[model samples]
Structure formats: C-alpha cells, structure tokens
Target: MKLAAATPAAAQVKADELGQIPVLMYHRIMVKPQQSLDRSTTELYDELTRLAKDGYVPITAAQFVSGRIDVPAGKHPVVLTFDDSTPGHFGLDAQGNPKPDTAVGVIERVAHENPGFRPVATFYLNKDLFGMDELQAAAGLKWLVQHGYEVANHTMSHPDLSHLTKDQVHKEISGMEDEIVKMTGAHTTTFAYPFGVAPHKPAWAEKLDGSYAFQGIFLAGWRPSVSPFDGKFDRWAIDRVRSEGKVKEDDCKQFCSTAWLDYLDKHPDERYTSDGDPNTVTFPNVLEDRLAKPYRAWARVY
Candidate 1:
C-alpha cells in the first residue's frame, strides 16, 4: 500500500467567477435556547466546523466592504456577523478572557483548532455591550477592536429607523457611534438596520455626516449578498442571510445556514474563490470594467 501525498500549497480550487459572497447573520449563542434568535452552542460549533470543512474562510465586514479579501488560495470568503449585545453573544470569564460557549468564544476556538481558519467577525452592537456590567462594557468593546474583530453600529437602542423622525434617526445612529468612539477610541464605519427597516422619509444614508458616514449598511435578508465587485452591489443596503437551524416566522425560504451551504455546494461557481494570491482578484473577463476602482489595479481575467 502507498502512502498519500501531502497537499500542495499552490494547488488551485474551482473559483467563483462572479465573486458572489455570503454574509451570514447570527444573533445569540446560548447553551439553553430561548426565542428564535437564540442558537445553541452545539449548533454554533457544528456550523463553524462545516464552514471550515467546506473551505469557507471568515472575513471582517470592513474587508468585505472594501473588497480586500485576503484569505488563502482556494478558500471562499464569508462574513460571520453577530447582532445585538446580548449576554449569550459575548461575555468575560473569571480571568477576564472571552467566555467559552458565547459566539465570540466559539469563533475563537474554531480558529484555533483549524489552522487556516481566520478568526475575524463583525459585531453590530446597540448601547449595551454584550450585556455585560456597565464597567466591563467599555473594556469588552476595546478588546474586540484590539483583536481584529469589527465593532459596528446597530443604533443606540435598536429602534425601527423607518418610524423615527430625522432628528431621532440622527440620535439613534450617531449616538452609538459617539459612544463607541468614546469608549474604545475606535471609529465605526458600518451599520446594520434594526429590524431590517430603512427610514421611510429622509434617507439615512444620504443625510449622514462625515463623522458618522457608513461605508456599508446591512439588512436581514434570507439570501446571499452580491459581490462588492458587481455593479449591482449596494453598499447602503447590503443583504444578509440568517444563521439558524430551523425556519422561523420572520425567516424566508432557505433561511438556515445548512440550506445556504447546500445551495453553494450545488452552485459552486456562484461562490467567491481566491486566485491563490491576495494581490490579484480573479473574475470573468467581461466584468473587467465592473471591478471597483480600488481593486481594478490587480484584477485578473479568469
């Protein structure tokens, strides 16, 4: 019997020509489930394990928005996002480290176990920071930023933007940005609409000042997000699919993580694929002009 050969570093995997990426939306990670938003620890671990086995590399929201995906060659890019600052989402242990079983803890652990798995994620938080004690909230926010994870805005109190006045909208969006800056000394550039509802009257995206301007805004969609490289990509209204085990009241068709993963498996060409080089992006030649200005310099014809 012959022994199996070692995998080569330069071997290329089948790549997604259009650069379509998936931004998975997750809420609470709890041991004991409560409500539809809460997911169990076993489920969370299983999902991460599946992603690793399927060649899905985690990227931060900032990287996805900027079109600067720098994962290893042959790995697909995916964004793992946690909404709200619930206690089950994140917390500190007795030694002041990230507690295991929480979303952040589980993510970190997965990355540790999987050598090439990137330990990056974006947390859209409200006024509350992981529902930790008031004194620990600031430190926790700072810790997330220092560790390369993104800390983004989710409004001051998670109110429905569609129902609020312009002034009220300003307070809700800018208030959280101000609080985050004051606490962690980090500026937030991304926002996720509460309840997936955009403002009905004055558009929030158009009225934002330089201090609180958002580069990307996310919605709670039960579908995959378009590539930032695509001309139809909307930075102000980016779509995200929910991460759950079963379809709930608000979930759309193919809402769960497994369904979306299976969808990608069925249509591998629609998923984002690396050219094995971070310096270059590979896509169809016809879309050459559609590449963002920042990424055009290194865009390669597939």
Candidate 2:
C-alpha cells in the first residue's frame, strides 16, 4: 500500500474551516469493578454532555483521517481516543485485568445512547495483550473494525522507540502493522509512539525516516496538524490534548473558549502547518514552557 501525505487542501483551509480538533486521549474509560478513575457513570455522562453543549464534536478515526470534520464545525472538534487493549475495557477479570464483556458493554451502551453521535474510538494495543487464543484476537479485532472504530499500532512490546536502534524501531512499528493487517485485513498506518517520545529534546534521539510504505492515519507527539516535513522531526507525531477528571464548571466556562480558538484560527501557520515544522513558536513562551514540560513528563514513563 502507498502511504500518502496530507492533502494541500487541509493547509489552504482556514483555521475557521479546520477549527480546533482537540484529540482527547483517554485510557481505560471504565476501571475494574472495584477500581476506577474515582468517577461515576453519571459523572462521565455529564462530562460528555458538557462537552457537547460546548460544541465539541467527538469525531471518529475515519472522519479524522478523511478530514470530514465540518458538521457543528465550530471552535471545538474534539476527537475521543482510548489507548491500551485492556480487557477491563470489556470489564475486569478475577485478576482485575479487562474482560471483553465489560469493555464491550461500556462501548455498546455509549453507542446505543448517542444515536447519530456514535463516538468513534481508536484502540492502540500490543498483540499479546489479548486472550491466549489467536483466533479470539482476530475475531475481536474484526468485531471492533466492523463497528465504527479503527485499531492502530502501539508497538510489539510497548518499548520506548526513542532509545531503540532504527532497525529495532522499524521492527516494532512494522511488526505490529503487519499483525493488525493480518488480523483485520486493512492497511494499518497509524502509530502512537510507545510513550510519546520523539527522537528530539530530552528524548535525545535523531529523527527516523518517514514510512514510505505505510500511510499513517494518526499518531502521537505533534500538536494537531503540525507535520515533520518542514524542519521539525516525526511527521507521524499527532499530538492529543488530555482531560483529566472533572474540572469545575467555571474552570471550563469557556470550555470552547472562543478567544483561544480565535487565536489558533488566526495563527494557523504556527499550529496547523503541512510545511513539516513540528516545533514552531506559537503560544506565549511561559505557557509553552508549561506545556512542553508535561509532554516531557509524559514521555519519560515509557
């Protein structure tokens, strides 16, 4: 399969047209029966409602890859993403790992209640994280893919790609792509760099070659729309904005803060560039410093 670059149309489109597609990264939406994110179902529903009222569109992987984020195309075009292949997503087992039944239950309920707003989620997983049965993995994959969801790569063993050799990185990246395609019959192009580390900054690594064979649908690292082609490294880097727990109503008052959105829209060259420069000075230096520190904090764990 031929991997292609993002369309020139995307670049020409105004920030008003593209808007702020906040890719919200989440993991284990539902915790083990006894263990949870200290949040209740009512609370989760409220958060979703609040986001909806704020004009956030929970876009799907397919919609995102296709650049179809136009409806309710306001200031916020948030993408809801889930990481890890935990069975607890299905529900927890006796050992507290995810159970297929539990996880699918949460997804099914969400799908049922949302009607036309079927929230599409991406599952980045290790091949071995599923059940012992290979057929089960294949079947489970087919089930999710057939639904409105997409499965992308999370590496073979979930190692820090920045620290590994180029060949080793290729193995981890391509091996998982091969596995997903073999199981689901679709070309797997996206990859979440194991722990959000790029071969730059404190990760202290060099950039790797862009995949000539795989077309990445989405990945992690760069902020929305920024690419590595210009001067920055890792075009595969697709940055996500994270929302932790429930913030006060006042805290998120401008949840879809028009001012911030307006600034981004006006300064599209800084944030959403196809020119290939990932590191552009856009936000205030102090705030940028604050944001950069967290991403670094996030990458070190892997």
Candidate 3:
C-alpha cells in the first residue's frame, strides 16, 4: 500500500523551493582506495544510489546557476560536478560508450537503474582535456555536450591565480575558453576556482567583455548552496561540498557530502524540493522574504 504524499504540491509532494541545494564536487574516480578524495567505481555507484533512493535528481551546474532547477514534484536537485579533466572522470571504450569505470559511466549506470535520475553532470576542465590527444579530446567533449552534460572552464593550467599578475589570470582562463571553443564549439558559462580561491583582483576571472562571461563561479567548499533565486545567493562564489565520507579535516564529520546528505534526509524541509512546475517557484508562505526581489513575479507562496 502507498502512503499519503507529504506537504502540498499538486497534492503530491513537498515544495520548499527556497531551500538549500547540494552542489557536490568530485575530483577523481579510480579503482582501489588511493586517497580520501578518490572514489572507486563501486563507491560512486553506491553514493548515487543513495541519492536516487532519497528523491534527488542530477542537474548540471550551469542549470543550477541559471535558476533552471526543473525536476519532478518532491524531487530535490543535486549538482554532480567533477574537477580536472582526468580520464578517470570521462572516456570512451571500444564500443563508443562511456567506460563503465569512469564518472560518466557510473552516472549513466545509476540513472539507468533508477528512473528519473538524470545522467548529467558539470565537468570543470583544465587544458589537458582528459589527457587525451586532440582528436580524442574533441570527440569526448562533443559527446558530453551532445548529451545533457555541461563542460565548463577550469583554466589552461590549474594554477593558483592569487600568485599571478592580472594579465596572467586573464591568460589562464581565456586560454582555456579559446581551446574549449576550438575543440567542442561550445562556450562555457561557468567556472570553478582552481583551488577554491579566486584571483587577487577577482575581476580578472569573473568576466571579460564580449569574450568570456560566467553565470556562476564555484568554490571547493563543504556545504549545501542556497537557491539561486534566494536573496542571499552568491553566484560568483558558489559553495560546493566535496563528495567524500567523513574525515578529520575541515569538520568533514559534520559537513562532507555524507554528513550533509544524512542531514538533508533527516530534515527534508531544509533542502530544495520541487513543486513539479518549472515555470513558477513555490515554497512555504513564511519564506516569502527570503525570495529575491527579481524573482517575485514567479513566486508562489503556499
């Protein structure tokens, strides 16, 4: 027998549209345990399975920043972001399908097993482009974009911009932009800080007139990000929780993906829940003040 739906969105689900969203940051997907940040193929699969069981759907970082969190009623939006264009993150097998051990591969597998778990993610790239040759790199990027995945700029070299001159910062970012366009023909609208920190002048990496502009800049932090429609949301320095189990560093016991996800599971009201209607933002009437002024016209208070 089916239990009754919780809250009231179409008499079907929870609709706290103003709640926090988990923007998970990943680094590498390798076989065997190597480091705290490294996750094996099975580990990746298990984590995603947990999310699917918890009524979460994957969306690209670009979509999150642009206020395009379109999902089913009662489903929460989660951004699965991978940094550094490593082969472990994406690659193809002899059959032209995503290799089963890569990040994309695991995502596809999980999505296949769990209905409505979109097999899409945002990958931040350095100039190496999966350490592949020019032709292979181009093919990989083309495949990702042709699908629903987002490919965004990291930099020419994943350098610490805080130590470089203003010109150097511009070169590092613009160089990757030029290369991305040259290879995949898709312009990136988002950026991830090389080390979760910005350039000394910040502006050098934020935008460049007519050449490069970003809808959002992400940081390697540990926390659920507020909705882009929230009045206090900061697109320039968006937070991303590292996709890892608990650790001693950075209060990971209370803040890493595992801890955060557990918290969200226990406290559903604090996380973003869709109203099944993409055109309008819906939430509890008490959160009306939290909605940004620009998004007022689309607001639906319950």
Candidate 2 residue-wise lDDT, 134-222, digit = tens: 76678778767776676777777878766777677766766776788789888654556556665333222222354314334344422
Question: TM-score per candidate, in order?
Answer: 0.90, 0.59, 0.95
TM-score of decoy 1: 0.90
Considering TM-score, which of the candidate structures 1 and 3 is the better prediction for this target? 3
For model 1, residues 60-138, the per-residue Cα lDDT tens digits are 8988888777887778999999898788777778897889978889988998998888888999989878877767988
Q: Looking at model 1, which ten-residue stretch has the lowest summed lDDT?
A: 1-10
lDDT of each: 0.79, 0.47, 0.89
**Candidate order by decreasing lDDT:** 3, 1, 2
Model 2 — TM-score against the truth? 0.59
State the local distance difference test value for candidate 3: 0.89
Model 1 whole-model lDDT (C-alpha atoms): 0.79
Clashing pairs in 1: none
Question: How well does candidate 3 match the true structure, expressed as C-alpha RMSD?
Answer: 4.3
Steric clash pairs (candidate 3): none
